[model samples]
Target: MGKLYVVGIGPGGFEHMTFKAKKAIEESDVIVGYTKYIDFIEPLIKDKEVLSTGMKSEVERAEKALELAKDKVVSIISTGDAGIYGMAGLILELKKDEEVEVIPGITASSSAASILGSPLMHDNCNISLSDLMTPYDLIKKRVELATQGDFIISLYNPRSHGRPHYLKECIDIIKKYRKGDTPIGVVKNALRDGQEVTLTTLENFDDTIVDMFSIVIIGNSGSYIKDGMFITPRGYKL
Candidate 1:
């Protein structure tokens, strides 16, 4: 059996991709991933056979990658850190007799945090607002718990054309526990082309600005804005 590399390209850009991720892809003979994600690493994967599937075809992509890996080195590409909202878990779950290796990449939360100046400097947890897999009540409960715990939160897949109100519903839950002035940072297409950054408060946030490509950071009570930077202090008194 050959090696199966589950790789994360990190926003599908060279700048955010880790050295190991690039090296793994270069070493692999075949690349498999979602169609849009495949386009991101097109420049690095020259001369290699590529297999692509559409939005809801994650299982098919994993199966194809595994089948190819049996006789050749196959790298399955993911956008963010493969384990977090990536294909790593699914690949692992479906693997029966394959040598699998997962390569991590920069996540949107980290990159967006950097762009918006350190909103994740302290305790934080990441939650995806899309309720395709999980129920909305459960997602709402998690958001409420995160708010009550006062942890800085990174929200992934906040909105889509079909579920435009999920993010707003979550914000309403947060507002019940958090003050209206709590800091919220949003970054769309983080580190990729036409990237956008907006630093706003919870009450003033414009939900129309976010999409599936956006990363939303909601600050705890300790978070504050200074010098046009959104910061969540690390609980250090200096």
Candidate 2:
């Protein structure tokens, strides 16, 4: 049996690719990923055969990687940490006989948090606003609980085309438990070219900028902005 490396490529950029991830891509005979994600690493996998597909094809993508692993070393790439909202789940779901090695990279949330300061230093929770697989009511409940619990939230897939206002709705829900002046930071293309970070408040979140590639972090009541960055106090009085 050949080796299968499930590598996380970090956010969309060559610089964000870790040394291990790059080496895996360089040594692999086959590369598999979503089309856009595959394109991000295209330069690194010049001689390999790439299998790309559209959204919602994760299961098929995983199967393809497994099949390719029958003879040659295959690298299945994902954006951000493969375990967090990446292809890791799909690969695991379909995994049966193969010994797959998972290589983690900087997740978008962590990168976003780093760029916006250390808002995740204290108790924090990562939430995906996308209700495609999860019910909205359940998501709302979690949002409410996270807000009331005073936990910093890292929101993924906050907004999309048809659900253009879903993020606004989430903000409205968060406002119910958080103060209107709660610090909310938006990080786009984190660690990549054209990276932008916007620090705003819950009340004025609508007026701020956002995109599909953005990660929105809403700090708890105890969170504050210091030295141009959002920091959540972990109860350590200095």
Candidate with the greatest lDDT versus the true structure: 1
Candidate 1: give the clashing pairs. none
Q: Which portions of model 2 miss their true places by more than 4 Å?
A: none
Please list the residue runs of candidate 1 whose C-alpha ends up more than 4 Å from where it truly belongs after superposition. Answer: none
lDDT of 1 at 69: 88
Alpha carbon lDDT at 217, candidate 2: 96
lDDT of 2 by residue, 51-158 (tens): 898999888889999888877899998999898888788887888777788899989889899889888988889999788889988988898899889889999988
Residue lDDT tens for model 1, 90-139: 99999989999999988989989989998998899999998878998899
Error of 2 at 104 (Å): 0.5
**lDDT (0-100) at residue 179 of candidate 2?**
85
